[model samples]
Target: MPTSASVRPALNHLQQLDGIRFIAVGMVLFDHWMVGRIELPLGALGVTIFFVLSGFLITRILLSSKDKLSNQPNGGIGKYLKTFYIRRTLRIFPIYYLTLFILYLVNEPPVRRTIGWLALYATNLYMARHVSWMGTVDHLWSLAVEEQVYLFFPLLLFFVPRRWVPLTAGLMIIGSVALRYVLYQARMPWFIGYVTMPACLDSFGLGAIMAFWWLYERERFGNVFSRTRWLWISIALFIIVTTLTKVLPAIPDSRGWAGHHNIMSDVWERLAASFIGFFLIGRAVIGFKGPMKWILENPVSQYMGRISYGLYLFHNFVFNVFHTQPTHFTVRAWRRLSEMMPFLNSSYFFQFSFYLALTVALATISWFLIEKPVNNLKDRFSY
Candidate 1:
């Protein structure tokens, strides 16, 4: 068996990106379990971070591998696709399917009849129409969107001539924005277009465009984004705008898009978050050092980043299970302790502490027992 160092040598060294992963997944966890309790509006910005990061990293990898892929069997594209899918399958399918199988066996009520959607990566579609399924495997909607993006965007990048990649990415960005506008005006549920591939093309496209410019047209991109001021400005603007409106609020709450707000506000907010993500990627790729850099590269933060995938997958389920009033004997003991301590009773600090510790423990277990083992196979089909 390969050591952890051998399995992810390239990524393990990219400490900044790992830090960003923690930030992204951290937002999702906070928004789901802590936002209502704490009144912070993280919402979907975290998920958008993942989307943009995926676009940038995947495009960068594919472009980098073009030459090596061309030398492979059956004219490059076949081998490229086969290798890409295999690596993705190994990294993503094991934990994902295992989670679903357990959910099926445990028969989580909301999940009982809806395992098909989650298994098929259509959870977003199923939940958009049937709000009842919003709590079970519902967070998988983002995963569905990602899978759909990977399904087609990669083929476009692989087959298109190098010169036209930018144009293709641009059209996708425009198309996604237009789709969101149309849906908003038509009074469709925000959930409808929000989780679908077409409406999210802009986020992915922005990142892809940045990746193309950076890798293929590095001199030009570097010239424009060289100064650290631009990145700082982008970050400031993204935080201000995204927090103003809850684009994709917590599931089952269902109040984010119901009022008389201008729908275009939603589009602009998403675009803003995507732009911020693009600049952050630029900062990392350009090796800029600043406060954000220090925070991302911190030791504790990096450890959280390493297990972010498992944390994201398990957190919602864990939160739902424990964030309620005590029902069982062991849990009643925990509630009693909360009542005995003033700080714990009023602030619920102990409850939060306990839940966070348990979730991290579970994520650690999943990472070692499931994810790491499967991810070791990733490099076998490395791009």
Candidate 2:
């Protein structure tokens, strides 16, 4: 009944999933503002959303493809990895590296050959070693984390047995849990996970696990995501709890190393946030039910949903260049500043709103002209 040619349940459900993308991307934007005036906000939770979404989407893609054929098709993993890397490159590079060029004019020269590292998708590693040089668009790190996961996931699917999908997925979760404890034992600085592979997996793996769970057990998800009252309340509670962790200072024992003292609790909070992301994703995939559903699945926001990838990539660039100097208010000084304009200066809120409006415009252009063309071009290659 099954053949190697068919796509495993084509990702037609992505439209339903679009709502979550808007939320996750919005989280990143909101969280960055925290970096300016606030102590903590759950905005970084957006990264968690991105990771979970990554796991869900990628796993689904692989599963769908595998459903149609064997794991070793298209000249085995050599070809698999090659084409996979190319797709990732095409999806991320053009606009991302272009941002770097724009930065050269406003900021510093990050790479003489920015094209090389981006083409290779090793920009994350480059950023890791040269942290200062990298975050020209600071948000690119999350994209790097997602790319790193992509690098490993296919190889994992290829070698790991079909029945062991759950096993491998569990192993990743367990490994992340265990790794955090070890980092705690080692007296790491922050409780929050960063660009490291272990921390990143929670979000990505959560998404992947959701995908697998959905594909093989649709009725189960149908029942869970369908429940409007109890589950929505639960999603809210999970959000509140996770939000506290990022902002509220943990009551560390004043006696010894805070990292080691609260390692278990710290790890718990991180996992808890991941769980929140996982559940909300399920809720989003199931689509709207009551008022919350209407809010989540709004039409205008859905357009934002389609160009979300481009929006996420270019948003900080828009922010950085626009609000490069938000403190100064003098007319002569403001006139000299290229970042500000009369429309953007309408009010403080408008300044922030302008960044959003401009980002959507740039992202829309990049999406159609650059990202879309590159995506179409990727279709020409097959493993």
Candidate 3:
């Protein structure tokens, strides 16, 4: 492994990461829009990618802050934590609460019923306990997981000595797998095993490990991840594990593996997905070459990635099939538009296109009107 002295200078921003976000969000949109029409777990894949990315980014930021604060004569740990929480809140809370409030006002039943959990970022825990989905807001479970991570991960990173961070992350990865196995043995529902915070830690842990390697072991990180074969191997591993859950016979009375009744899903599929996510993220960090670079760095990809949070937040509401009544204003408007245009309802492609366009438009508006302005506030609280 190469030392930090031989590593590339740390980047202030990586446009390629936004491109990676674009890919992740795109997978989610495709999975949701197509729904039962497709058999793949694209949404889960996308969310796992997000978890890895979040883990990597958040860990890196906290580590950087810790390093900076250690050297400053007047540095205070309190300020380190305060600034992190404030900036994170500014970026995440406003749009989320606004959307939730609007949904509550519109009397969306699921939101009305689960607003407390949703508001507190406990939707995943609630779902695990209840063994049910919350209609269009089911997607929020991932967001909730991330918010919960933000709540505690910084403290963990801040206090742990930098050299120990990778070991700590490795333990988390192992603990996640163990927790999933325990859930499976306890005869818990697959959803419980899948959505709970402990079971999802592997994704975050793997990401943290990647970030640690990049920061402190850059030569090895660059050399290992730069090989395209590793990326392909991870992808292959993910596919094989996922496919096995489908092909293997289900255990008696199992809630279904990966939502299919197979006993093979939650125990290892998530870990496999995390590995792929780790590699994808690693490649993005180390940088892509030729066409890959062009694809990820393109203006359209960058813009979409920039607005991905809005896209993820608004998309389900915009094109939801889980709810009978429209949860979003755009959905309601589209229903009325379809009534007049009629042709909009004639083809699946047209419906998808219309809904996607609405999602993008709404997200664009949100970027300009809500998110960007709120994000500017982050500058005042910078680390």
Candidate 1, 163-209: lDDT as tens digits: 89888889988998888888766766666767877888888888888
lDDT of 3 by residue, 92-208 (tens): 999999999998998888899999999999999889877787887988999888888887898888778788998999999999999988887887877877788878999999999
Task: Sum up the clashes in candidate 2.
Answer: 9
Tens digit per residue, CA lDDT, model 2, 169-224:
87788888777776656555442335566666666666777787777778877777
* The best candidate in terms of lDDT: 3
Q: State in Å the error of residue 341, model 2.
A: 9.7
Q: Estimate each model's TM-score.
A: 0.86, 0.79, 0.92
By summed lDDT, the worst window of 10 consecutive residues in model 2 runs over 253-262
Ranking of predictions according to lDDT: 3, 1, 2
- In candidate 3, which residue ranges exceed 4 Å CA deviation? 1-11, 72-75, 252-258, 326-346
> Would you list the C-alpha lDDT of every candidate in the order shown?
0.73, 0.65, 0.85
The model with the greater lDDT, 1 or 3, is 3
Q: What are the per-model C-alpha RMSD values against the true structure?
A: 5.1, 4.9, 2.9
